[model samples]
Target: MDTAEPTTVGIINRENWIGALPAPVREAIEARMTRFTVAPGMPVKRAGEAATRIFQVETGFLSLIGLHVDGRQALITIYAAGNCFSETAMIVRREHNHTTIALTPAVVRQLERDDFWELYHRHPEIPEALCRKFAEAISRQMASREQRATQRLGQRIATMFANLAEHAGESVVGGETRILLPITQSNIADIFDVTRQSVHREVSHLKQLGIVDKRHGDWVVIDSERLRQICSY
Candidate 1:
């Protein structure tokens, strides 16, 4: 990874954590941030490593991987641009519980643990923003657990794609929406706690229905409404 000095302008905006802060507070936080770039397939932070910093993704996608004692790895989640993460580790003063790996060439900004506390104490808005972020994460976690418990395999898969299209999709030609992240069948399988073959079958079904397809190696939602309808049922 190559590190860069802080810039005068702040990158935080209303879309992400700490972005909703006042301009001066955002600038103050940005002043303490150091930017870095990571190559695809590189580990941004490893499990068991000291968590002395909080990170915000400026570009590209990252995978949060959870490792078990049985030597198994699971995809916990994906972090895209404008997402901030690792705050829990920093807050609890614990080592990272999961590994973060870059899925594509990514630019990230990190604020040291010490600087983070200083800002937290100095700015009242910081804690409020963090609380909101944590709440959102918890809500998503609960929804995911519910989804895994109550939904069928195919329904879960469709719901995952629909959620991705809403959160991380870019409009493409011909009314299609392409998922911005470079995700694989294995990744989807990991997220759903299912086998890759199972995911492949569901993906094939979606393709046959003309609801989704791959274009230029990216997953495209051909009919967003139809995909959502699949999720609804």
Candidate 2:
């Protein structure tokens, strides 16, 4: 996490930003780009730190978390593989809004704030894409906040499962079946803004109703389409 060496997002060398740009322009940006490899449980940036760099994730998950006044953290959002975080930090050139933490071993590419501004000036389309991306982030945050404020515990929990399925789920060979939730119930509770005990009880209810079938280890899936229909409404 020490921003000292350049190897932040090790595998990010392959990301394509300006495919239509002339060769020289792309070369200029890539020359200044740097990558790094970081381990799990490392802090990428702390709250209130000067936003020195924008981070693009090559692989793994990153958490944007708000630490409560009582010292506990409420995870606000998760950035997955190929998505970029900390971009707005450079856009505003201000302090970080939330702490960024790696959930697993990850690669993060860094672009200095000044370098980003330079790139934006030369390639206007890049800035437009970044603007749209930031807007989407804000909209997602607003939706999550609204859902947390108005939804019931069961609904929020179900929404969490759906979000995970959208981002991380993989299809099993069982004829179009998909699986992505490898997290324990407690971790799922943390993600859903609920108590672990609540998740345990609700999971029991899901099992009883045949909404989810728990397999060996952390594997679980919906064997029936009825699960999705009931949870969605």
Q: TM-score, each model? A: 0.85, 0.74
Pairs with backbone N, CA or C atoms under 3 Å apart (clashes), candidate 1 = none
Residues 1-233 of candidate 2: C-alpha lDDT, one tens digit per residue: 21112111111112223333456765565567798877877888899999987776767777667876898776666666655667777777889989988866888777787897888898776786666555655665677667667776776666555546555656666633354434567566667657889989877877787666567654455653655565566
lDDT of 1 by residue, 107-184 (tens): 999999999999999999999878877776676667667777888889888877886787678897888999877778
Which one is best on lDDT? 1
Q: Give me the overall lDDT of model 2.
A: 0.63
Q: Residue-pair clashes per candidate, as listed?
A: 0, 8
Model 1 weakest 10-residue run by lDDT: 5-14
Model 2 misplaced stretches (Cα beyond 4 Å): 1-31, 145-151, 172-192, 213-219
Give all candidates' CA lDDT scores. Answer: 0.80, 0.63
